[model samples]
Each structure stands twice: as C-alpha cells, then as structure tokens.
Target: MNAEKPPGSKQALVIIGMHRSGTSATTGALRCLGVDLGNRLYKGHEGINDKGYFEHSDLADANDEALSALGSSWDDILLRQENWWKREELIPFAARIRSHIRKDFANSSIWAVKDPRVCRLLPWWLEIFDSERISPRFIFVIRSPHAVFRSLERRDGFSMEKSFLLWSLHYLEAEQWSRNFPRAFVDFDRFIEHPAQELARVEETLGISFPISVENAAPCLNQFLSRDLRHHQERESPESSPVLSLTHALHQSLLGAVDSGQPDSLEMDALWNKMESIQSGFPRALVEHIRSSGSIQGNLQITMNRLMRSWSWYTGKPVRFLERLAGRNV
Candidate 1:
C-alpha cells in the first residue's frame, strides 16, 4: 500500500471523533476557513446542533449501513468485529465514499469530511483514500468523557457508564488506526475557548493552510461556535474506577499531545490493548447491572435495543439472547 499521494490528487481534511465530541464544530470551522464541505448536508436544527453538522448525509447514511452490514453501528462500539475493516461487506461502501471523493471534490484543492462514524471506519477509509490517491490529514477531536456523557444523557438518554465506555473504545480505535496518517488532536473545549491558537497549531503541524486565519474568521467562528453550542463542561476530575481512570488517561494524553504539539502512540497503544482484553466482560457486566433493577431497565430499554441488536456478533452470544435481554427485564 503506497500511502504517498498521487501527483494530481487532492488533499482531504478528515475530521473524526466520537459522536458529540465537537467534530461538528471543528468541521464548521474548516468551512469558515474556505474548505468545501458538500452540496448536500444534514443541517443542524434548533433542538440538536444548531451550528450545523457540516457533514454529508448520504455518506453518513452509507457509514451507518456499512456498520450495520458488519453487525455494528456508530454507537455499538463494543460489538464491532475484530479486524472488521477487511470484511467483504465494506467494499461497496468504500467504493461509494471513494467515488464521492473522486467526483464531488474533483476540482477542490482541499475538502473536509466530517462524520463521527469515520473514526471507526478509518481502516476502510485509509485504504479508500490511498486508492483515490487523495492525501488525508486527520483532526481527532477530544472532549471530556463526562461532559460528552452529559450531552448524550440529555440528547440520547445514554447511561453514563455506556457513554464513558464508548469514549474509551471509540478513540482508542481511532487513534490506533490513524497512527500512520498526518494527524493532529484538537481539544474541543479549548478549541472553542481559543480557536485561533489551536488551529494555528494544527495548520503548522499538517503543512496545510486554512485560507482564512482563525483570527480573521472571528465573526464566522463566533456564530458557529456560540456560547450555547458548548452545552457541557465536566468540572469534577476524580477517577472513580479503573475504567474511568483509563478514560481520563486517554483524554489527558490527547490533550497533552495538543498542549505540546507532539503526538504520542505508546501510551495509547497500551490503553487500546487493555480495553480490548477487558471489553468482552464489560458488555456482560453493563447489561447485568442494567438488568439488576426494574426502574432503570424501563428507562434504558429503548436505547439498549438500539445499541444491542448487533452486539451479539462480537460476544459469541446468540442474537436471540440479546433480543430477549433487550426486550425483557431479565
């Protein structure tokens, strides 16, 4: 796999992160910098992210279908297959994305692709980018797991533990898979606090330029990253459990890399290995805990159904078991 860019290939700014971790805001900033997003987009609404997603809905839907083909969706982090990217089902979706890149952005010098699903789908996308001959520079958005959980809690009604676990698993895979790419981590909290400082650093690292400086794009940035756009900020810093400790460790390491303008993989590699070894037990434990009480079960059943449908593929459990578990108290 020659990862080098082809002579006439375009530059692709691949914006990735777990859902609600500010990928939207970061991509919106890219738009403010004169990067072409796409013709069709899923515009943000009053209740959701009013700043707009800056994402291609067709591509997002393709990602969802591809994940479903693999028995996992964006939120079903634990249920994804080991080495899933190599599966035959992803080829069609990869072709779709690659074709979009070739046709949609053919004239573009650089364009941005913003989708949380891209974090998990990087292996397929890396190959796609290579095949398309486009050079991809990644921006991994980071946010406090607790704060993200609060956002998910209000919006999706996800349990705190599930959200934290998703944060750990999602980024662990994203960082590991994107290790070889030209990439930079951006702390969304701080990025919103001071866009100019963070983006200046990001531009310096990627050898890519955003047409307008963050300072120059002040009015656009202000409108996109409004005070209300940032809804949650986790103040408590205690690591209450081994898993939370690991989550915090990943969060800190990402921010530390941002702080120092250096990317480190050794620590993240260890965290990924740990998460993999223990995650099979994690789903069972979380499910049993959710089932232990009848009240929480009712509150979580719909969300659990949405996430659990395809998880059976990963745990070697029958699909019926998860179906029953999701449908009933036991």
Candidate 2:
C-alpha cells in the first residue's frame, strides 16, 4: 500500500500527544476507521498496555538519542524546537520519517502515526510535508495535568514537583503547534466516556470512516489502559502513592539546578512555580480545565481510557485469530 498520490491529494492524518497521552488510542481509532498502521511498530513493557503499540521504534529511539545529545531529555526539550522551524538540525530526520510514511502508505488514502516524540518535531514536519505539498490532518489528545504528572512520575520515577512542571511544559508546547495547524484536541476524559463520539469527531475532521471495534479488543486495551489510569491517580490513595522522603535542602537543590533555559523556570522559586506559568501560556480551554480540576484522580481515569483505546492491536484475541487467518490466506 505505498503508491504515490497524484498532486492535490488530501493530507494524511497524524496524531500528536505526550507519551502517555492518548496518541495510541487516537491512532488506533483512525485504524478502526480504515487507516493503515504499518507492519513495523514499537511496544512498551507489560503493564502499560498488554497489546504492543505500532509506533516506529527505530525512528523514536534515534530521535530520543538525538534530543539527549542536545543536552536535553525527550521530556525536557519536548516541543521546544526552534532549531526545527529555523530549518537547521532535526529537519532531515523528520524528512526521512515523512518519506518513509509516504512510501509505506502509498496505496492507502488514510493512515495514522503515533510517536510522542513527534510533538517536538512538528515544525520540521510542516517544513517538509506542507511545503512539499503533502497535506495532513492532525489529532491532538490531552489528559488532565494531575493524571499526566502522576503517570509520568511512575514511568520515569520523577518527583511530583518535577512531574507536574514537565507535564505543564509538554502540553503547552503541543498547544502552541495545534493553534497554528489544522488540528483537533481530544480530551482523554471525554474520549473514553464516549468512544463512539470521539471516534466520530476524528472521522469528521479527517473526512474518513474508522470502523474498528473496541468491543473485541477490550481485554488487552482495558488492562493496559487501567494501569496507566491507576498509576496517575495514585495520589488519591496517598497510601498507595510511592513515598520517598525528601528534605527541603534536596528540594532546593532541584529547584536551583533546573535552569535549562526553559521559559517558565524564571517565574517561580519553588519547583511547582513554573506550572502556573506554563499553563498560562497554553492555548486551550483544556489547560484551564486541568488546572481547576486539582484532583489527579480524574486525569488517571482519562489515562487508562486512552491507553486501552490506543492499544488496539493487542486488545482482543482476534489479533492471534487474524494471524491464523492471514496464514491461511498467504
């Protein structure tokens, strides 16, 4: 399915979000509606999602290493790519990935890609695809800050203070890009509560139908989604939230060393100080909603729901069954 389209073709559908954000679910939803997910994919360790995800592992790993070499972690430099917009570094990498997508999905009219790292490389994408006449629609998924921070904390072992700050920064970066692009933001909370409605929204935006069913893939989806949700809301049960003793001195040490030239770092003295600044700069109502929500519990629920939806490939026994059927077909 890799045929080149004639000029003036409708753009491809690209999904953007934080790592644990509902990127996978959104991509899977598109797949359900007839988007082709390439054969090669990346998977997470067990517990996050039982079914493996379909991200391009090679691309993501290489990008992560590149980002680190620039003196920033993926979570740290997320969406902060002036270099990309200036047509300097990282553009070539984006070009390669975009080329691969075009080559791989040549015969397909619709396809979806989910790589959290894409959040930062958007400007490069626009430079390559949009300028070169490859039109593409974007789907952005968001979860509450509380959920985002909590889930991230568990995954990275980052402190809540650091987690919250990073969560805010990540969303703000994504929001800035979405505002200037053809995109839609799917609130993780809203999507899970009404999958059909969210899927329909995506369908309407991309002008395509995604008919895949979550009913059959619920087992893997549900489990993967559940853990993400549970981990994020752990604060609700302080007893379950992993507790590590920290001294005021250590807190100060972290706050003192956080000067990586991030814009929000200068605003507040405490680690959580920059959160408000980042949230203020975000260009969406969801940011406000998340700020007011206060409780991480809601966000946790949103995470689980999105995770389940994203892990469509592993959701049901049909995947194994389909493999057998394919074997017969081949």
Best-matching candidate per TM-score: 1
Candidate 2 per-residue lDDT over residues 178-251, each given as its tens digit:
44345555667666666666666655655654434445444534444432332344233242221121212222
- Candidate 2 Cα deviation (angstroms), residue 171: 2.3
Candidate 1 local distance difference test against the native: 0.75
Listed per model in order, the count of residue pairs whose N, CA or C atoms clash below 3 Å is 0, 17
lDDT of candidate 1 over 123-234, digit per residue (tens): 7877787777777888889888888988899998997777888888778777777666677889888898888788888888888977777678878877777656678878
Error of 2 at 262 (Å): 26
Best by lDDT: 1
User: Looking at model 1, how many pairs of residues clash?
Assistant: 0
Instruction: Indicate the worst ten consecutive residues by lDDT in candidate 1.
Output: 290-299
Query: TM-score for model 2?
Result: 0.60
